[model samples]
Target: MSESSIAIPTVYGLRSSGNCYKVQLLLDLLDRPYHWVDTDSSAGATRTPEFLALNPNGKVPLLVLDDERRLAESNAILCYLAEGSSYLPADDWDRARTLQWLFFEQYSHEPYIAVARFVRRWLPEGHERQAEIPRLLERGGNALDVMEDHLGSECYFSGGAFGVADIALYAYTHCAADGGFDLSRWPRVGAWLERVRAQPRFSPMAA
Candidate 1:
């Protein structure tokens, strides 16, 4: 399709969500212009009939093209927007390797880190979910240790350069301390976070 024939996409997301912020970060980094619809899942926005029509699974970070086609999942949207950009690896094994880390972020990293952040930072104190904090911190720290070991040997995750994997892991890992995990214990991961921030067009997560 011609460039003009393609529709600009709209993102439906909560500004504070790391998953949502992942898409926002990449779109800004690529200099791709798009619309943002601030939808908070915590406020029952995702469960609305209109949003359910767009994504039956009812999640934020949903991307809707002007043509009405929709895409879901933060990492999937990252890969789509980053196609042909330096944020995505071009080499065969490198791209697969990037996917590996992306999967690791979702399965190992985000589950622990993101959840703890949500419960600790977003929820009121004494909320029932605060009980999960201990387990979350333990697993989240394990994930960070893995990253620390890998980063001690190399600069970025996956392709020896900045890419989607970095974006994926960087989202929650950088804010892990808010979840009660001490970043000082993982110096390599700390340095990697700084490296990601130094990349051109980087933006901090919404406060």
Candidate 2:
């Protein structure tokens, strides 16, 4: 591609989605410029042929480079965007640690927490998914406990710094209450949320 043909990166995302919000949060924290094409997966935006062509997974928060390269998965996108930045550590072990938490957020944390929020807030009352909330809360609360325990000694998730891992965890954690989680139950995690909010250029997720 010609140098002049390259433009700022474009992110296809849903503003209210924690996964998508993670990308927006990091871009803002880095003060990086990009285009945002709002894609609401809940509204079937991602399932369309065009979006599917971009990401076969049919997920939002897909990053399209100015050169037309596409990347998917929120955590992977964070690592790619944060490369060589403070958000992604230069040290091998630190980077591994960051990846560890990133994996945790996806496997142990987001599945229960984000889904609970979706079931409770997005799905209408009496929906079949509502029955899952109680179990979801149980599992999600365990994730919160793990975070609280981790925060008891460490201030941040990304190798002792405010970085992409924090942003990843924070995206869903701050709004965890919307999933019927009582943040008060995890005091350390609650305090960590405040610390994350205090970071420079920190942007609030859409309501």
**TM-score per candidate:** 0.96, 0.96
- Candidate 1 TM-score, true structure as reference: 0.96
Compared with the true structure, all predictions reach lDDT values of 0.89, 0.92
Q: Tell me model 1's lDDT, rounded to 2 decimals.
A: 0.89
lDDT of 2 by residue, 1-207 (tens): 343332578999999999999999998998888899999888899999988889999998999997788989999999988886899999999999999999999999999999999998988899999999999999999999999989988999999898999999999999999999999999999899999999999999998
True-structure RMSD, every candidate: 1.4, 2.1
Error of 2 at 87 (Å): 0.4
Which ranges in model 1 have alpha carbons more than 4 Å from their true place?
1-7
Colliding pairs, model 1? none
lDDT of model 2, residue 182: 94
